[model samples]
Target: MASSWDNRVAFVVRYLYDIDCNGYLDAHDFHCLALRSCVLEGKGECSKARLQKYQHIMLSLWEEIAQLADFDKDGIVTVDEFKQAVMNCCVGRRYEDFPQAMRAFIESNFRLIDLNNDGILALEEYRYDCVQRIVVEDIKIIDEAYYSLLNDDDRRRGGITLTRYQELFAQFLGDQSDDCPAKHLFGPLEL
Candidate 1:
């Protein structure tokens, strides 16, 4: 009974990971490789430092989505596993904390995580989801802060570059944006 339940539960979690996460067999599995490549690969060189920084961003993004994970087999919370943390977060269309198994997510997560039984999760796979999520989230937050003719028109025009995104933050969010740098929205990540 125990082994059967474990298998079933693990299967469902994998299903959910495929939907939201980069669809690795499991989110934890993805992190396992990302940590090694991004952090472990760093050395006493400029590239090494650059890689580590990217790793940090991936970790942060993972942390954000992980708030919705489910760990306990009882469909309840009792531990602090990353899976449990992820299931606890806000994801999906409405950002609602819907309590569903991993198998439930059938949305187009192909661009984010693919569940093709691929054994390894590359840096690109890991970072793309993180960066894209960060961009969308940042845009939402920015739009909430300001909606002037110039501000609203620029984003609509699509002429605004990533470099100018920082200026947008400084202009509207102002001091609230102080704690976070504009570069965080999107920057070249090599790891």
Candidate 2:
């Protein structure tokens, strides 16, 4: 029971990631990840302890913005809202919001990602090469619903500037924007 529950928790975390649980690189998987993580709780495999940590991380990472699908204020993450968030994050030119993040913060984050000393990217790395632009009002608009629920320290590293905030946002956005094959939670469809 515990292991199965852990896998589900991890699955929510995976969905919260830039990629899906199976590591497929696309909005499809990312979105699927969000829904399961958020709205699909309390049904045997869903509960408080099951998703507490995952909620904390997601709020911190996404800057507490409420995705369209995240109708409920719970932090676990929902597939529809997750997909909506991913689409909003990636629908820019070369991830235009990257530059909005703080320079030093972005540089430090880059070092952590470029671990192999190679200019190329690798797996499990969540850094963005593009600069994205996020309107403060727009961010506020999106987060209006779930703002207070994510105010706890469980989801943040204290205070983050607008630029530093944008940097993290862009990295997370780019992480799931790929062309990989999809993985199905309902099991694979028969041909």
All models: lDDT? 0.33, 0.35
For residue 1, what is the lDDT in candidate 2?
26
| Worst 10-residue lDDT window, candidate 2 | 180-189
The number of the candidate with the highest TM-score is 2
TM-scores of the models, in the given order? 0.25, 0.29
Error of 2 at 151 (Å): 42
RMSD of candidate 1 to the truth, in angstroms, is 16.1
lDDT (0-100) at residue 96 of candidate 2? 54
Query: lDDT tens digits, residues 90-159, model 2?
Result: 4342335532322333333334334453432222121111111112233333233123212334146332
TM-score of 1: 0.25
lDDT of 1 by residue, 28-98 (tens): 54344344434333422336565555445444444433444433333322223533443333211122233
